[model samples]
Target chain A: MHDMMIPFGPAHPALPEPVHLKLFLEGEEVKDVDFSVGYNHKGIERTLEEMDFSKSIFMTGRICGICSSAHSTCFTQGIEKLLDVEIPQKAKIIRTIVFELERLTSHLLWLGMLGHEIGFDTLFMLCFREREYVLDSLELITGKRIVHDINIIGGVRRDIPPEMIKKVNKNLGILKDKVDYLQTLIKKDPLIKKRTVGIGNIDKDDVEKLCLVGPVARASGVPYDIRRTDKYLIYDDLNFKIVTQKDGDSFARAIVRVQEMFESIRLTRQALTLIKPGLIRNKPAMTFTEKEAISRVEAPRGELIYYIRSNTTNKPARVKIRTPTYANLMCLNKVLVGNNLADVPVSLASLDPCLCCTDRVTVVREGKEEIIKLEDLHGHH
Target chain B: MFHAIVDCVGDGLIVDKIKKYCLKKSPWIFHFCTGGCNGCDIEILAAMSPKYDFERFGCLVKGSPRHADIFLITGPVNKKIKSRLVNLYNQIPEPKVVIAMGSCALSTGIFQKAYNVCGPLDKIIPVDVYIPGCPPKPEAIIDGIVKGIEVLAKKVK
Candidate 1:
């Protein structure tokens, strides 16, 4: 029997996102954890079906604010495949640049949240202060700060002018130094080490079993990045290493993400240099036949896959998204069960669960959990 | 006759004035994200960070609704969180103000046609200020909170 069952959030102080976890504890040690997401679901897949392909691209970008570009990129890549269109080389480089910068911002945001969860306000402050540089560069390129609607169906909607490139490069230069300082601080800080070092340990085998992607898998020594495996979006041309760590703990995850930020900085700079004078969009024909295309991209969190099906019209018949958090969520029990109650927030944040992306279609009927199809959802509505 | 009446009421009135002043200076905030994307929530945090420094206006983001003077709400309210949002609003003590941040909270934004959304926050609760954006910039969020503090001050009186 459990000594206590504490409900953490639909709204909680530790993590502001809407995920509810019922923690069964015995003397401050968490014995079991049952978590439910779907508080943030807006039935996006169903909504996608109602909108045309051109409009749905922006809608997909709003699916998760942190990984907005990743969703749109994946969707666009899938749409391009369905239309049998090839985006220009310049457009591919531009997408890659925006993609990496978005990763930098998302990872920085995650790092700050980790600090806040552990009661280190200074680290949080420092991370956010540094994050503005990345946000500014993104704004310079994409004309928006948070939800960057940079991708269109065939290619990108905007071009990075030469003057903007210089300014963005300058921002990246300053950011590189600040990131170095932060990396040193994380490595040396005893408080952070005490809070995260061995907490929420997931072994490599567990990572494979759970089929986790992104930094979570990399932290467990699994080099299963979609960027390397799929090599979509000019990643084939770019030179970068997949960051991996062997510990498979919270600290290892932090290390993997921090190291990847450096790699992102490098990749973004490389992709920026590769951006030559060329057409940004291929402007494919709007017509479509019966087709289905699955496109994958390594988002800041992990592998984000978009399966889009189109009929004779421009509207996608069915759009399905598989976000990384959905897969990483499987190990929540593994992370929380043996740990102290105080570490719950840190451990959970370490997994970097983006509930906005994860909670799309979940139906509970007669005590059985099922994923209802978009057609069924629409009919019920 | 006027002097005698003034002397009697001045001390209590002075104390009340000081109390109101303090309330206006430091308006503790409680942030809740109903169901929108995390854009606004992160923007709220950014406002609190050193760059925007919302704390300069004596605003602190509190965890519990009971300790809050202004409720900062983001996202379009969804069915799952509707009752919870109302319950949370009721939990805040009297003299509370709600500032709806982001376009979604104002009118459901792009998710207006979404099946699960049941919001535009004001339908569920009274909203004093609306900061409109896909996710309003941190500066705008801070500005909205300052306005919320003003509304809270009026409510206290």
Candidate 2:
């Protein structure tokens, strides 16, 4: 029997985002899988090098629309560490609220896309509709629905206006009820359960071996939520459970995200209540001496870490981002092998891979393409 | 036999005209996010959501370029996907319209000077409509597609 090779994406509806996969198949069963990314590389790190510390926060914010706040927050945190500036308490609370709201929107978008992949159009539309409430809240707070450039070095650009606070809470209340409904639908819907249950199963061992993070790891019962582990922002002060499921399948992944959205909602509420009138930013010195710092945040996908090095000038000497999706790519290929061809979409979606976050640049040197791995990058010498 | 052949040709011309008219009335759009942020892509999806519902004008978001009448492109085209974007554009039949859906698609937006970017869709393909925003709102997207329908009508004529 001749095994045919088929290439998927860079563009395909099944995997909505960009990434190319080469699948070797024996009849309907996938035998081997190889993949390449960088279809979304925007040269963000290189761009950061030329700009001063202040402007690059907006650049990093554009890294991935789904997790824009996370990137900016991570960047700002790293820069603040370099400058040795402490942002005001109110700023930290505002940042936390925005981060969790982004998580809520990102998960809702992922859930809707998953429903679309499973051929459940109703759930897809419903999730997206409910997501509007989150978007509206974000727009009300940050002035933009998608790319909320709320973060600035040493603090945030805007405060939560007093007039909008009541409006924000009202929207969250409606959203909470809708998300609870969604959780019930995901749990009890036979169609969703039949399609997702027992699909893309991987034990905790493989998840660890691949060095996965976020809900993907949590779904496998790894319990590695970065907000708790890193204690960044005001997460340490907040009370929230790290939701995990042991089944390690697509359904388990979905359950983990659904549970996390509820947690994010709770976190957002808590952070909002904690918000008070105070200074939002600390003014830093105009010049930079050589210094470096690393910062991490629990982005919607997983752990997002930013490393920044300050040279003698205001511009950064180097910036490195280790996004969660890059780590999750290992498990995508591992799970694809031995699965029926039809199950491929949901299995891949279960990982919730964001190529825009993962693929920063594809460097071609001497006729060979090379991707810089996470560990290879270091701060300025 | 010659009279019958002439009559058949005349009927075929009328059938072709009807098809062309239908194409203007309902142009299927296929969206390709080459690579900027996912902001424009989500706005496109939001436009298709029940609240905005681009389908009211009989337009549909098609899965295949071959079946589409308009190509809704978002993001600045990354270097790696530029060739793929061209390939997908070629796959769509002519008398088609291309709408550059965001600031990135129009001028590469914030990522304009990046090394990996190869777009501002007009540089690679002939763009009929340009909706300018970091990510254009859903109402604007609907308006852009409506403009695309007008472009399609011109091409058909």
Candidate 3:
């Protein structure tokens, strides 16, 4: 029995933000694991409480940079739902296109990071080298790459340009070939195979109980994708298969993201063909109708949920965001247990946890006095 | 008289070597998210990725008291996150440069005039290099990093 349990981090090189892991170890194998988060909490939820309707849009986007588009989209969709306004079909299609672009960028980043974690430095470079094309294409089309601010409450902000369509088609071809080549490499590469296979195994039945989503749940063979199961935007019109694998391991998660990249291209091309000329913005309500609504989107990580309440004012009464990484983090305890300490980074990264998206909540035990931040974790570092 | 100056400078070898060393050493950067959005954070992750190679030049996004020779920030620094902006700027380690990569980090273009947004990265975070476009191209980011090094060299003794 080890006398002292070492706390890995609330701040460490392994993670961008602070996530504390209490490792109970007998040699290399972890006997028991305790994890706590909230170091990066910004009191977004509480802050949203004081903000108005339109203001909530920008606030929600801050939940996580990678999925900010999905966040804003979900928030705006929720507002539209509360108002019971039917969005234009053209707008819907554009929303789908932009959403998929965000997914592609996010997944590509995850792939590169996963490669780096296992010491495959060259693969990481290759992935980012290819990723620059997507960034350029997104910049050309949306006028910016990251927070497109494309989806508005009633519609999108801009129309897809003709030159942009050509760029998309060209890049789509390149991405397809790249994804195909990398898929083969990832499958047969001994280094990747050795590092990822069977590293993070979650029980099949535990998924429903744990409430996992996106690639993590799908990789476990749950076949639960928000777009397929709960269609949003133009997902109903676009035809793309949900990528999944039964192995429920880190490799499975990696493969799921790889396949999704191809699907994103197919969806984007179809969207481009389907997009028609129409008004990009509908007249936004001058005042809210004072109603509550829920909006969900298939973020690159998983189903992103946003709940907003408008109090007949420009400011929202409340805004709640359930980021995909938050839900996925719940299952980390199950995944991390009984695995070698070396596998910790892969398992955690496999969930693709977005620390920025999660609300800060931490329970610290020091000399039997537990400290809870309540909703005020924002002020603390 | 002119010939003596050229000879002392070693036929621009000093400049070329300095460019090479600084390009590989001090890549100062500023992070800007034009419209208080966070997507730039993820995109910047591409550079930080083992593949994109942000660290090859010893570049890092410093937090506070601006110890960073480069300002590598994310988001447009929303009204809520704006208060932290002063802290972020003050913490940057001296002789710094800033790079605003994303569109939101530039002008808050799409999200302009929305309630509760300070809007535009230049409002805060004194920017040096502006990589325009929604999320600026990664090559653009690298280019900005290189340019930042050049700018830093010119300012120094």
Question: Using TM-score as the measure, which candidate wins?
Answer: 1
Per-candidate TM-score against the hidden true structure: 0.95, 0.93, 0.77
For B15-75, candidate 2 gives per-residue lDDT tens digits of 5676567776678888899887888888888888888888898888878887888898888
TM-score of the second chain for every model:
0.89, 0.90, 0.71
lDDT for model 2 comes to 0.86
- The residue ranges of model 2 lying beyond 4 angstroms of the native Cα positions read A361-381, B1-13
What stretches of model 3 exceed 4 Å from their correct place?
A1-4, A360-381, B1-40, B48-157
Q: Indicate whether candidate 1 or candidate 2 has the larger TM-score.
A: 1
Q: lDDT at A356 for candidate 2? A: 86
Q: Report fnat for all candidates as fractions from 0 to 1.
A: 0.82, 0.73, 0.26
lDDT of residue A67 for candidate 2: 91
Greater TM-score among 2 and 3 belongs to 2
* Candidate 1 lDDT, A163-279, residue by residue in tens: 999999999999999999999999999999999999999999998888988999999999999989998989999899999999999999999999999999999999989988989
